[model samples]
Target: MEHRQSFWENLVVVAIALVLIQTFLDDFAVVAGWAWAPREVLLYAGLALDVFFSVEFLTRLYFSFIRRRTGIYFWHERGWIDLLASLPLVLLSSGPAALALWSGSTIALGRASLLNVLKVVKAIRIARVLRLLRLLKVFARIRNTDSTMAQRHVAKVATLSVTVLIATVMLLGIAFSVFDVPSLETAYQSRITTLLAAVEGDLDRGAPIDAGELAARESSLLAVQREGRTLFSRFDSDYYARQVGPNDYGFAERGDFRLFFDLRPVNRDQSRNNLIYFAIIVVTIGALLFAYSPHFALTVTDPLHVMTRGITEANYSLEVKVPRLYRDDEVFELARAYNEHYLPMKDRRSAASADGFDLSMDDVQGLLDD
Candidate 1:
């Protein structure tokens, strides 16, 4: 039988894909100049997409399950993801708190659950979203598996790896925060209280306050609050010079004292480089692996996303993968070197764009020769 692709199914995939992209790839600054109108509206589109997917997934699942036998074959691999991406939203109105709890737990798992929701996130161009493609591939493989054992094992590994990784990261963050937050919090609270008390006696206190005491009091409070504000909030020089200032939250964004913040290896630029690198790794391995073909349809890589417009490397990718997929030679060498330069090609191409993309001409020529 010819396979029929459902409209809802396509949207199901897109919805999750969008979520992944938005969560991950950031420009480090607001994306101001994109063609999108009233940009915040686009964010609302996400919520709408989520709602549509939820309804579609449920209606399909409900009726399909009633017709058990055919539904087993017709619905096939993605039922679980559809269910997962769908249910949480439905639970929202009925049980908003439950939904919040669910989201919290899922986010705590990091890439694991994110990878699944990301499959539905749509064409979000953000780079971080591409990382979840690896997770989606695993889901696809298990879903396409012919036998119970194959699907079961794939399921097991995906679950085990995701659960373990998320649990580890979550616990570590919690433990570190728990262990380290107190000193900073204590410093913040103590400083603020001291400053507040002194200010209150002079200013916030009842009517007959002395004007001179107000100046001295203000000065003292400014100094104290300045210290508090600088630690957790934005730097305030005058406030620091004075005593009481701001009640601000942290000594430094709450996590500053953690070892991860203290000893984190990647600088901001390097962090961007790592994400670009990770995107390459996940997207490459996810698609290239003939292993994942069954469950989810692999999104073909766009050569355009691989290269910056002026970069010599961008021109090279156009030559290799453009018409014919995969090539070798001087152009091929260039493409290979492109991947080889900083990190593997596997890590670079994470997200897709609607603009038409083509492979390099030389690679196309090589393919025709073969």
Candidate 2:
């Protein structure tokens, strides 16, 4: 049972770390226009992790009730934070259900406005920031464990670095959303208008321009083009001269003047969507670092320091017991070994002193005589 519990705990830790990393990469994919397949896979993996976390949380609560430790568990563990952290996943999964119900029902202010409001409410997924509280809980648990002052300081520094990195990423993402998107949108619109005017001028002059030439010209335009929808010029031999189409079209025949503007919303929405993912990614990373730093310090740094201190004090004829670690791991085993050796050596030293065996001169003179 103990081993099984340990396995689950380790699995949870690994899952949390993986999810944090996956979320960050998923955000990068959104901003970089990478393929969606890997991002979708990560999303499903995150959902699976969320399910595991939810089950773990409920299992803890159930055991707490059964053991009559509800008060102590809630007070010390702050189990409420776990519930808050899990809420985003639950709410996100239920969004479609809520939307479907809203769609089927009638609202006094019209379904369009109500649907918009519901869509905004879906942003509640941002509440995933509450997951950071779980990190704080982990930090607290680590601090309460047997660890040296040096280890605690190292953990603090690591946690601070992670926090700063997260803040920097969020700021950079916000700047991209606020400035870069608008500037790009403006440039794209300008390009579209320029192309339209050039085609129009050619049509006015009755220039014999083929549809293929126009398409080739468009292909030569800048690469940072807006995605989703685009505006272009088309030519149709049967249509009136200089006629603009409402939708995108293929190249036109020679002397057919057709312009089509792909009308879609600006890139602001795309940027905002990217920013949302960025926030989620940053928060998850920060939380994971905060939670893991202390564990790392205790496991890797604390035991060595304790052993060093014990040896140093022993040189001064002062017996120093190695501090016992709360974790029953390799570090604890090392501490136990040190104590085992120290106790026997200490007893031998005491026995020698009680027998009045002065090692300075008398013992040396006796050995020489023999």
TM-score of each: 0.35, 0.42
Looking at model 1, residue 146 earns an lDDT score of 41
RMSD of 2: 14.3
Residue 264 lDDT (model 1): 12
- Measured over all alpha carbons after superposition, the RMSD of each candidate to the real structure, in angstroms, is 19.3, 14.3
Candidate 1: give its CA RMSD in angstroms: 19.3
Leading candidate by lDDT: 2
- How well does model 1 score by local distance difference test? 0.38
Candidate number with greatest TM-score: 2
Model 1: residues >4 Å from true position, as ranges? 1-5, 25-39, 68-155, 167-203, 206-370
Q: Give the TM-score of candidate 2.
A: 0.42
Residue-level lDDT of model 1, residues 109-181, one tens digit each, is 1212322232222111222222233345345533443445445545554544543443454355345434544
